[model samples]
Target: MHTHTSTVTSDSPLFDADGVLLHRHPDLWFEDGSVVCRAENTLFFVHMSQLARHSVCFRDMFSIGTHSTGTEASIKSESGVDEFPDYPVITLHDSAEDVGNLFTALYDGPNFGNNDPLDFRVVSGVLRLSTKYIIDGLREKAIVHLSQAWPTTLKGWDTREDTARSFEMKTGSSSGHMYPSPIAVINLAREVDAPTLLPSAFYDLCRYTYSQIFEPSEDDPLYVPLTYSNASPAASPGPHSGPMQLSLSDTQRLCLGKESALHAITGLIQSMSHSQSIRNSGVQLQSAFSFSHPLAQNPAHSAIIPHASNHHNPYHIHFSNHRRSSSNLICVSAAACRKDFSELVELATQHYVFDRERGFSDPLYVADELGQLKSAEFSNSDAPECKACARSLELWAARERERIWRMVPVWFRLSMDVGAERTASPPVVDIN
Candidate 1:
């Protein structure tokens, strides 16, 4: 699903247009290079036989008109692209970076060996170009990694922390730092017939703020850079600045998914809050409020809670002390803890430190929140808290996390788990 931009050369021309029959990128020119792969203004020096061996498309394309007699050769007549008399120039419709990366992956020895580039852009480029150019094996590898990030089973989902995952960024930008663009992931999943990936991808996408969804800042993970293309060096690129644009339906799907996820989480919180054991336990302690905390307990109000996101489309949650609190602090057990449904959700949200713009409806945030119940240090000498209650809450969170994980496909309105997908019945005997 790569959006190709028709390359337009700078009006100044590459060294006097007439003198230059073709422009070769010095960065990619190889001494033994046989073929020239052109995408936008970028050109890559590569071997034809190597490309032909891996991609049936390249094989079939190269196989066409192999013996064109003397001087005649197949060349693209598109503007700004000049066919040269030297090596064969195979013009393509994808971005230069994508084409370059695809060829890099193809030519690179060991097939995903050491020092191989596997960032969001590179993997995405490999996925799209491999599928398009019919490169063997790369597509499946890309799919496997993506599937690992967004598994089809609760087992895979629950054991995500244990898995050799690389979805998060080192800088810690929450929803914005580590993962690929949610919209891009969703679109690519649809394009590749990967329905199993939709649930997690959609859920992750729903966590982005409206601005992050559209115009992600330079600091945000979704922010796309201006790629070097034929459309002048000064021209900006990437999803928001260039050819990649979302359809109306894409917007609706994301909004709907976010809204649904919010409702489900809210319901789960309410249900967890009303447990009979949670209400009756009598424990008193000082408020866990601090200046650094956005929403902390206040003496004026009976309770302290964050403002729930607006209930309209493009909705998001915010932590505002001015908000009328929907949650109250109460001891879950006699462990001297006073935090109710709202408070629990709030604590969990804080643990993950989700994007302020999008709030915390993310499934990942929920898992982290639950994990914190057992691990969070509450027994400070000044604010001495309960470890027993923490352990109990941790167990409950584990159970709830499992339940939520199972219902992911359902929440996205999919029926993948029905029928034979659940089990393999013994083969019926035809002897009767």
Candidate 2:
């Protein structure tokens, strides 16, 4: 004898038999809709035609006999009795907010042209559902929106940094106010398998201290909502209702990436201190700026500076015995220019770039600070002469920053083509 297994479907209106009230979405609930979707405590009454139009998953589900109005498909209370006006109900495993955002994108055609704080919320929520339901158009749109905020190019990163600085200067507020928390971005990137977003996201997350990464405070931007709809009340404990935690794999990625960033900081200092050819000019080295390098103080530090005839090193500024040409800007008072470069490098080391207490892990910020040495405020009163050498220094710093930016994906161990603007699956991170 063959035994039949009957599946109970929960599709009741308003409330289930368990007294669990399902809140109907204020904006998404259409009275004349053909289907109802229950996501946790929320209910969305939407048209099946529209769902099938945007989502292949829904269309496939409908193509099967699952939407039938047979007794097996009828609404069943907790007690297994049929009830309610017969509308086909589908239960979504995703959060109600995500479902709502997905529908909003599908119906309204992805309008994300706002500078609000909740922009990440809408993009992330919609992206999750769109990717899940195989909505290619919506998924691509969401990726574009995400890539704009957390861009792939070095120029885009520079623009984003400049905009944050501008916002900070104009409003006298923390630059953190202008962008979403990178921790949240990292989480979203992993959740949606968007590997292209990982490099910038991981680099941005390194801006926070070691403590801040693991133990974000109450005011931390990580707690910001991933989706905020003015039309709907707050969601209960759900996917995006609270701050998201990184998986052990992601945490390992972050910790290792942060260490690499610190090493890059040392690399910036070296590039500023050593990697320049005073160029066809006679610049004599001076002992004006001979402070021990911050890295040299560490016990595990390597001898990055070797003993050479008054030449470039972290501890001393040495130059070749080439004759100075009075006509050349860098060659004119070359010793003074060398001293000025050394002094500015020391100033940047102690106050701006390499200070560990300040927790400055941002190589781009370090590069920008190093580049700012061209100004009279940083250099000697002889702005014309000092600026010539400072310009070379600035160029070197810019190049170092670009190099570091390119290495970000490698540092994070993300298997992404950093040169390309496309998504990939999250790499299988090995915590072991």
Candidate 3:
């Protein structure tokens, strides 16, 4: 606020009228300030040092002796009169509300309100201007807020303790208001090129029907933001209403990502469901007759141990089955073994489709399980009815996990031996 400390003329009312005439916004007014920033024809009185500290863009701009838009851009006039100087105004193209939101986070200390669920407007504004102005501190703060909404890592996703993720309006017609959609967040993420937020945002989007995902107002591309003033709740409220939205190109990319994920995962699951030919892999299942099968009836065959101490012994399995022919290998407790195998499959499937409350559109789960290396989960909990059956089942399960491990990248649809391109369908099952 600037005022004439001295009376310009006697009729000017000496020592009576207010000193300054700059219009001040309710939310943006700072009792003490260095310069005024204008946005959408609205003026925000703020401190120069505070803006400089938080934003390199603002810092660099402030460093210039002149404001680029006005006479401040040039050296003082020959008469030494400033270029319409009313506290060195810097005009910005952003909306007044957005600019005000951004400054509140900055000058008031980023987390001033201490609200659990953030005001969506504040979060979006901070992210937008912070990124635009190269405000690393504020950008990081906004990313922290974003991480709460979309966990960046499996661990973070698993531990929902990160924060109660939600959004609301702080004040205005929308005070205490909840925005029913994440589209706002999603659109803002895209506008800001925020990749970390994409996976969860896209996953959240998948839950909505195509029509529900996009509102009719979205066609305008400009009319969808339920501005804080006179904002109306989206008539059909669900989980994803906000200013952020997916662009057509982004929507197509998401479709591709989903297709690739499902295809690779389905292929991996199919490959894992069937038994592999172990003999071709230099592994064999031996007759354990230890459980009183025909082979165990032959005392001589029962003498061979699991060969645990001798890696020299070729991989083999022993089972008690009625028909012991040259090819068909069977487990004495075939049902139990099958049940155990199913549990592993369930884990693999869960990994592929979803994990840590996060999502997967592909067979990254194969690599994830393989990375864990404990793929074969064996539970001797109640003990199998037959020791020979248990032994054979254990050996078979272990061998299968090892085989799967060796073919992880392949199971994940990688065509190359190490990391070839993944196919949407299962690779040819190697008979060998």
Candidate 4:
């Protein structure tokens, strides 16, 4: 067999050096393979035809000459007597595990089993190498797997959250373990030019406390395993093995996005309990509840305080003066509805909605909690919110959550295209 002989330029001992060893990829090596590809310390004996068929980069390279100018080395045959041809070794500038994963996907197909946390390594490896090699099919598949965690649309986001919540309930651990770390996800998204993944990643990362994001402690809840064990053979040390950090620019964007998310929750609270709305109902609703806290006494806390000294109700005055008919007022029992609204506002404020220390500043979680106020379990009052008032608040909170989802890209300073594609419903992906 004709052989391509060339010198190895790696820092390690020369290929022919005594006692030097190279690991052959367990799955990718084929006896009849026509070419060799080396990534870091591992070598893959794979057929050139399959790679050429799927990757434009490989096709173009093979057309010219496969690794003609790169490192070349010979290996002993099974008998250790005859030597295999010194196949041209295409030195890939990627990690061995990543190359192994890429070849596995190329041969066995990307198995993203149930989009499990461990699947992230495979997905990311395939994504990185596939994009580099211009393997569009693998790249697209990897993205589908990623989308299972970092969804684009609000509905998809909710589904992802529900799955995570369920996982947490089952495992008694932080739901963060259900998916790969968002810091790693963000970095991979940037590396692969997949901006669509950023908003969801950023939003997920926002759930962590500022210290957790910036300086995670050794016993950080984000790293703790519940039921999921990383010791499984399928699990390898990956980006989640340690505190992966965002780039300085990404860090800045994350900070801005986090602050914006906090403000979004505050904005929702303010909108739901605006001063004008409070003043209109305060005098009548004041009979329902009184402020015991000093901060609640200040009118400046209108976002949480519903009591206002203003006696005039513009809608009532408008009706009393015969300027508008009573039918013009949409709320039939303004006092009762307003009373319920104030109690709900107070309930939300008292919760961890604004407490970064408690790591409950996530707008989605806060909004969901608000939505559940219509349910009996989350209601603190003697009576649940009136059907009309509760339903209105629930619907408005749902819409507001969607609006916040849409604004995530804007918050992170991502391009409008990121938000545009994400606004639509997520397309179904078969991950079998």
On lDDT, the stronger of 1 and 3 is: 1
What is the C-alpha local distance difference test score of each model? 0.50, 0.61, 0.46, 0.62
What TM-score does candidate 2 reach? 0.73
Instruction: In model 3, state the lDDT of residue 408.
Output: 29
By summed lDDT, the worst window of 10 consecutive residues in model 1 runs over: 423-432
| Poorly placed runs, candidate 1 (over 4 Å) | 1-21, 25-36, 41-45, 65-89, 110-118, 146-175, 215-219, 225-245, 278-359, 367-390, 413-432
Regions more than 4 Å wrong, model 2: 1-13, 17-19, 68-86, 113-117, 219-243, 275-330, 352-354, 377-386, 416-432
Q: C-alpha displacement of 134 in model 1, angstroms?
A: 1.9
Model 1: per-residue Cα lDDT at residue 226: 55
- What's the C-alpha lDDT at position 339 in model 4? 63
lDDT of each residue in 347-403, candidate 1, tens digit only: 644544433324546654464465364336463334445443444344344445555
Clashing pairs in 4: none
* Candidate ordering by lDDT (highest first): 4, 2, 1, 3
lDDT of 3 by residue, 60-158 (tens): 677774543444222122234342344566767665766777898886777633322346556667777777777777777887876765655433432
lDDT of 2 by residue, 275-311 (tens): 3324332344321121122221233322222223232
Over 4 Å off in model 4, which ranges? 1-19, 66-72, 76-82, 224-242, 275-333, 353-359, 377-385, 416-432
Candidate 3 residue spans exceeding 4 A from truth: 1-23, 67-86, 112-118, 160-182, 215-245, 264-272, 275-334, 337-432
Candidate with better TM-score, 1 vs 2: 2
